[model samples]
Target: MTRLTLPSLAALLTLAACDAPADGPVQDPEPAERLATGPLTPAGPAQTVTADADVNLQHAAAVVELDEIQGQGTLTAKLFGTAGGDPAMNGLYVHAAFFLSPAEGWRVFRIGDVLDYRVLSTGPGRVELEIDESVMDPETSEIGSRTRRMILGWAPGAEGAPPETVTVTPAQ
Candidate 1:
């Protein structure tokens, strides 16, 4: 049997609250305003997640239901990431999987090398993520530490299709 500690129970409650559907569409108050700051702690201790992709888990995994975002249905979104690849290709990699209700498995998406990410908005069938990434110097073809915004949207259908991703870079 699994033992539920106070902290784990609290986390479960918080996850439940987040998964709950709102009365209507949810929106971000501001473009830069963050919806949630940190990832929700899973019941168990953080461990390395082995996947088909060659990457190490960077942070604690989070669970969010797509129904809370898109209002489509009860599809669970497992969000996690990796520290990165080699030193030359060091960058945070974000991964998200959608578990379709009544289905036995899930569809995973390896969201490229996002240096950092923020939850911009969620609900109404769409989860917008504002990712801060390092931009390379096009002129010199050298990767620099300069950071910019790369927005990603995950609005998959209940059929478990690929997520709708959009990367937008604001004018500097």
Candidate 2:
């Protein structure tokens, strides 16, 4: 047996430890590329509406009704914007009144008006409204608006009804 010095023993141990296992070639991994630091390129083409597409305005109105009115009211045509050449006639306009209750009195409501009890949504031959109530916060004494949905329909034969004879009912 040969006697080994401390330096030689340490060197041999280092060499043995550094030996790679007999699996495959050892190579350093490629460095990760740095991220670009400027305005980002769009991932895809810009979205656009097709001119030939049959855009259904009725469905859009129904979505707006669900989101806004959620309630309903009967509207009679006291008067409406005349068709043709009138920019205001782009949408339906009607001068109608809402009868909430005998005590509350008959109140006139126009399109887009936020009244004490209701908000009116008017369209060509369509009238809808949402009942609104003011709620008072006990803690901060702040008032907030609360809406209730009413389903509007025509009654079979009710007196003092509109020419269309619509009735308001709480939504199921």
Candidate 3:
């Protein structure tokens, strides 16, 4: 038997990230594609929500949102239930989703009454986002069920997002 060392594993992971589908868009995702087109296998640890932060209350229906980006801003939303109707949301529901297929470009994945997508991943005009698990229904299958691999095909920052700001400090 052969075993891969740490360096080998790291190298493989990095390569996978680069091959990840970014420019792709979800024109009209198919049924089967929904399941397979998941977990890009190259994303950072997504922070989980526990019914706090911005919004809450997961009713029988999901609450979706299309974050309003100003210029180069990042859409950061919160997940978790407050005090609502449906208690079934306690399970592993899609709190949020970030879809972007070769055809779609960069459209955020959301659930609820409406599909409020938010662009996070950036590539020339794209960005990476940690999709929550509040808007997922592995049981539902209605064709346009969800934006599995959706994308944003238009002028960068079409959402009128403002220039983003990030504070960085070097470690000793």
Q: List, residue by residue over 110-138, the lDDT tens digit for candidate 1.
A: 76675666666665444566666666788
Q: Against the hidden reference, what TM-scores do the models get?
A: 0.44, 0.23, 0.18
Q: Whole-model Cα lDDT per candidate?
A: 0.56, 0.44, 0.39
Tens digit per residue, CA lDDT, model 3, 87-130: 33323232332234456533333222222233455443333333
Off by over 4 Å in 1: 1-72, 87-90, 101-103, 154-172
Best of the candidates, TM-score = 1
Better of 1 and 2 by TM-score: 1
Runs in model 2 deviating more than 4 A are: 1-128, 131-133, 137-141, 156-166
The alpha-carbon RMSD values of the candidates against the true structure, listed in the order shown, are 16.4, 21.7, 19.2
Residue 86 shift from truth in candidate 1, angstroms: 3.2
- The segments of candidate 3 whose C-alpha lies over 4 angstroms from its true place after superposition are 1-87, 90-124, 134-172
51-91: candidate 2 lDDT, tens digit per residue: 55556654333221222222334423332221222232222
Worst 10 residues of 3 by lDDT: 163-172
lDDT of 3: 0.39
